[model samples]
Target: MDNATAKNIREGLKADCTKCFGLCCTALNIVASSDFPINKPAGIPCVNLQNDYGCQIHSHLRNKGFKGCTVFDCLGAGQVVSQVTFKGQSWRENPKIREKMFRVFPIMEQIYEMIAYTAEALSYDIPYALSDKLSAQLKEMQSLTKLDAEQLLSLDLVMYRLPLNKLLTETSKYIRESLIAKLPGTKNSKNYNHERADWIGKKLRGKDLRAINFRGAYLIAADMRNTDLRSVDFIGADLRDANLMGANLSTSMFLTQMQINSAKGDINTILPTHIERPSHWIN
Candidate 1:
């Protein structure tokens, strides 16, 4: 019953709940913070959780330190486990089954991964030549997603990830094709097109440049730690070797996945969009 490592990476972006059962919040103990109020035990609902299964303090989570809750995405692991596998008999409505729901939560997280991968495959704009093969893989992944709770709980995920990686490689190529092509032969550099001029290779730590359009500029080896870059457009900017430790760029925009992954960030760095800083960047 080993859970297969999913071949799809797109699932990480969109966790599907139609196929999930809300297992993580229901089965796990979300630590008490100013937002959640109560440090409920495993399988027990948070005091903030209402009868409708929504957090009563949803809007005020950050004011309380439940900041962790905002970033905790089950990747659609909850809904799929509850309604899809268990036939909607889990803890969303009935409180008595909380204990059993907690036990099944982790296993359900694994099972939802398969569905996650399948969903990613469907998002592709693949070449016509590869459509048939892609369709077959998608169908096979969907079938695995329908396994019962017992079967899902016993899954071995180590072996599952290998095939998923292979499938993801193909999907990624198609996704790239779906994006609007940039201008031909344009160097991948940052352009200070906005009122903010270029600052490539500048030693500018502790400088504040919030709300600037830094598109298509070269910021190689720039020292930008502890600076404010909130609401900056980093499209086509080359931030290779830029120091972003302890920087505050909250509420920034146009920082694509590639830019964030390429640039360094630690817990000390305050990210835009309320993302939790990485551990490495912690002070």
Candidate 2:
């Protein structure tokens, strides 16, 4: 796909709350933990969710003990579910559709996430065949987002997710080899148990971790201060509470807004152009 098309796809994957019905806050269940302070069942609106679909605690979710809310990103699935799948009628307007809408919300979220990853893969300077495959998959997934509520609920997410995951891994390998293959002490991100004993509190200071495969790694609270994170593949990595103070992530692949929200960073942290430094981060 062309850069313009890729840009459009990326833009479409962002959550636009104004066009949404606060589906993430309502449709998904929340377990009481460090991430949340309350147990809320699925299909139930959060106590802080207002009638207009805005969060009553939007500005103070973290301070109000709702860290999970801050970290959840629907990747533009909310609006598509609210506006497209349901034809712009919210469950509030048509109360009969409430249960169905709730069920479709999470399913649509997975589809959008797959589309987001495929689009990201297409943005790379990879081989023509790989780009073609990614572009085709991106189109197929984009079409899936337009499916009706019942259609979405019937989907086997693994079918789509598995192929996308494989393609992303291939893209990661290419990017990693081209950038850091010759570097000494290069680490394999998937070899978590053998290489790194644990996830939290890992202080990888002064590490040349370029083009590392951090996909699906649990990096909760891993200290990454002053690290150059360029060419890092962060797809599916658990970045919750990971310290990124002064870390450079300008060229990191598959890093999402939700991951950024989950992590701790500072003003000195260099993020991608599309990712804004969280205001809640240390200044």
Candidate 3:
């Protein structure tokens, strides 16, 4: 998907904490780390979560050593559970439903994430036959998000995501292969297939890495500064602390907000238009 598609999908799929009941703060397990200052169990609210379902230290979350909260995007699942599945009933107001609501929150998260990926896949200029198949799959998954809390809890997320992932993989091939054939001097897609690569802390700066498949790669803390990352597939790549300063990822495939949030960048780093540069990034 292009940057426009990314922006549009994100406008819809991005988190709206205002409409949520602090599901991410309450329902998910948290461990102490550089990302978080304390341990919090599942179904328990964070110390900073207010009674009105807002984070008391939201504006200063990173300053308060809660960097984990900043990178966690629910993909609009929190509101869907808060309003649709449970019908605006909060764990506090209806304590009886608290455990079940917590259980369904994660399930909804998976579904929403899958839906977001499918929507992104449909934005590609692939063949009509493939587009129709992707559209159908997208609709099917979208409908599942409207199911009741009981139904959502029972959903086999892994089973649903498996088939959708295959479709995404196919779409990735079509996108990368087409771009590979277009970029001058670049070899075939197979020549750059670095799928599941282990490149932790590897220095690869200022390289012409067009159309490379870095899917499922361990790119953690890798020095990728000023590299040409256009048409690179970042699906399931661990880019934590990766140095992306001055790099060009304007046409990268399968890139997500979470991935962008975790990595470092600068004003000169050209990102796909859909991703807003993080405030922590250097100017």
TM-score of each: 0.49, 0.92, 0.94
By summed lDDT, which 10 consecutive residues of candidate 2 come out lowest? 189-198
Checking candidate 2 for backbone clashes, the offending pairs are none
* Candidate achieving higher TM-score, 1 or 2: 2
lDDT of 3 by residue, 1-283 (tens): 3435644764478788899999999999999999999999999998999999888888999999999888888888999899998999999999999999999999889888888778777776888777777777877888998999888887888888888888988988988888878877746434789899999999999988878899999999999999999988999999999999999998888788889889989999998755778888899
Best by lDDT: 3
In the predicted model 3, the residue pairs found to clash are none
**Residues 1-283 of candidate 2: C-alpha lDDT, one tens digit per residue:** 8866786677566789999988888889999999899999999998998999998889998898998887888888899899999999998899999999999988888888888778777777888888888888988998998888788888888898888888888888888778765665545543322122346677786565677678778788888888888988888788888989889998898999899999999999999766767778999
Cα RMSD of all models vs. native, in order, equals: 11.7, 2.6, 2.2
Measured by TM-score, the strongest candidate is 3
- Candidate 1 per-residue lDDT, tens place, 1-283, comes to 1012222333244455445444555677765554355676776656565655666766766576665555455655576667666678756566665566577667656544544544444444456545455555556656666777566667676566566545644554444323213323332343323523466678878976654556567776788988877645564577655788888766444344335544666677776442334332335
* Candidate 3: regions farther than 4 A off: 1-7, 186-190
User: Which of 2 and 3 is ahead in lDDT?
Assistant: 3
lDDT of 2 at 151: 83
Q: Model-by-model lDDT, in order?
A: 0.56, 0.83, 0.86
